[model samples]
Target: MAKRRITQETFDAAVRENMEEFEMASEEALREAVEQFESQGVDLTCIVKAVAAVSSEDTPEESTHEVLQALDSLRIGDNSASVTEVEADMKRFTEHCLVGFAQRFLAAQKDAYPVILSHCKKSVEEPEALVNALSALAALTNGQPDLLEAEGKQLFLDVLKKHREDPSVTCVAVRTVRHCCLKHEQNRQDLVKGGVLPLLTGAVTQHSESAALVKEASAALRVMCYDDDIRATFGNAHEHAKSIVLEHKGLKVLIQAAKTHFEDTSVLSELCATLSRLAVRNEFCQDICDLGGLKLMMTLLADSYETAELVRQVLSALRALAGNDDVKDAVVNAGGVQYIVIAMNRHMNNAAVCEQGCGCLSVLALRKPENCQVIMENGGALAAVQAMKTHTNSLNVQNQACMLMRNLVARMPQYSQPILDMGAEALIAQALLTHQYIADVGKAALRDLGCQVELRELWTGEHGSLSY
Candidate 1:
């Protein structure tokens, strides 16, 4: 039997018939249709196109399952169809909403790991195939990162090193690494051990023009930095994340990227998050501020309406930078105090922003009476009290708010009467009574509020004894 001659009319009619059958096909019928199409040598692209034409709302789960099975059966690697065949199959899967099949196929097929690994190894000369293969690996191991850590870690690192010149390849490679590192500590440690930071930093600093590369690299760093062990490895006694970033000249790279892509909120958000993570070390606070991180953060808080993520990161970074007196003075001079208060009020419902806002106020109010006065003038004290009252269940917010209140009243004697009048004492009392773990901070705040004797008596009455 000769191959059926599939003319344009024949192909279109086949697609139309398949589309009609697909709309009403049951699971078994869909499987049969897939078998018939494959047996007739119908182009996979046509089937994908026909299925894609159906309204996604009406596409049955069985149809998706059959389509995924057919697409995954496409041959890849040497001695098989050309790279174009595998790439087209992958493109179709990704484009036609069948990408979910990547994970399912890999999960069901025991040999998928070796098969994808072989293809990735052979496709080094082919960037498109390499990217698609990496993407497939990423999808397969997305939530299941042990697969990548066990097999594909070195493969991905090699891709980043060898294909640094190709922004597309670099982008997908870093993104794959980022996905593997998502919520998986072993994968993150492997990435750090594999020297991912230098590769990612090089991608950002050396290839500054590729916004996609920079964004993905920044995002990868952001995820990697979340691990305290990784952060400690990057930071030292004199600097937090700043030492490592500065060692690779990554700070300048990141700063330049933030400046260059000022409008790209995704880039800025990740970059700022990375900075905030680094600034967690007290030693890096002054360095971050001196390196112009303070100015950039102030600008972002002042202008961008992108998302709460950026605002959250900006407030967090400011909270870290405000630890140093010089940095605190600079922040106040840059009108950061006002913006911090604004963030508090704008995202009043966001516990994280409220916590960080109050944190910044707490640190700034520590030694700077003038800064404390500035906070009081900008309603920082009231905001802190309100945040504590609003997030009564959040021990973090309550503790930080208590610290802020204590700092404000302790440093600026003039603002003590104003804070008391705002009913901060009531909020503190509530925190003391509700959260015993934070009772110490609350008790200290009461003392700072000029109610030490009353707080002692209240504590004794509540607990039958007073420890502090």
Candidate 2:
């Protein structure tokens, strides 16, 4: 037989009973309640395991903050509230939520999720109340992803479906969706299964003129494609990315939004980053190229090369798109080599830009001898060596620079000595000595560039054969 379990309410009731009837201390009562439940084989992992603070309506003696008081007012159990009452309460809650995470954590501990969820459910027909409720929900769930359960997931998708025509509602709803799904893999999977990709793409397409809405929806789309949640043994992040591109035509939608928001550097940065996230497969890489994404990225790079953050994103997108052989040729032919070199030169002090720029050049020079000459002639090698010299403390930049040097000289050894003359050997040796885990690429760069590298023999067979 399975072990019996009890609800948190039941456990709390037991603790409260011990406190009031038996005159036990609060801590003693909690301990007794825990022991009593564990003795009965009742699982308490889901229980909050704390005495109920003065957060509810009946508890008038204990003091609570205004945020908790506002949450208490929004509790919609038996009381009937007018539209104005709901709107006022939701607005108060949203304002309080904006205060900070301390108040949000307090409210979450007080079971504010269901109270706010109740308001979201009740205000579905009331646009004013619904938007305020969603804004509060979004703020409340920020970094409190444990509050978003199965019901919360369904409510998010339902709100998106119902309010698809309302950009204001969809915008906040998407913000809430992004907050709920971040660092919560199950929520991401569930929302994507509930057909969120098409809705997100539609939001981007429908509200193309609204830069704020487009940015939020685009960010949410990118969040769905993240595999950062560590709780799951495996995730469907790749599948979601594919669904966004192959099934829902996400490339066209994002590329169009990028064009629409070309002047908005913030929105363009987000779109470029999301574009990199969506380019997970080789065909998807080619799809980005065919959809004019390559040209758009080059233009963005040219226009925003001075903008460090935007330059980094554009370089990342180029690196992702360069995974394809034909895309590599396309990028090289479209002045990509020169753009990457210029971006790196402009942002020589920015480690992230240097990393992405070196990575892009490395991929463009991989296995393509013709492109290697273009990279060499365009100061790509010098830019990479300088990136290493500038960001010596940045292991990512060093590793990427090492890879770029190797790729530049892998097929076209004629450019090796020219690059080595630019102080490549010293930086490569320093990187190899500094970061052991990433030294393989650095070591290969040194060896391929005609520098003598010490080959460490790790294991030996019985016949004296060795392996690294």
Off by over 4 Å in 1: 1-85, 88-111, 183-186, 228-243, 280-283, 305-307, 432-437, 451-468
lDDT value for candidate 2? Answer: 0.87
lDDT of 2 by residue, 1-468 (tens): 777877555776888888888999989999999999989888675455667665556863353567766887778631687767867877888887777775687688888988888778877897767898889999999987878988888888888889889999999999999998899899899889888889999999998999999999999999999998899999888999999988899999999999999999999999999999998999999988888999999998888888999999999999998989999999999999999999889889889999999999999999999999998899999998888889888999999989988988888899888998999999888887888867789889999999999889876754766799
Cα lDDT tens digits for candidate 1, 1-468: 544434323433454455566664434444555567669765443232223223255643323333344345544324577767777765554443334543334333444555556777888889988888777666655555556645578888788889989998899889888877876666777767777778988899877777788888887877776553332344222332443466666666787888888888887877887776666555567767767888899999899633677888888777777766788899999998888888888888889888888888888888888888888889898898889878998889999999998888786666777888988888888887788999778888888788753444535435466687
Count of clashes in candidate 1: 0
Worst window of 10 by summed lDDT in candidate 1: 46-55
Segments of candidate 2 deviating more than 4 angstroms: 1-66, 76-89, 461-468
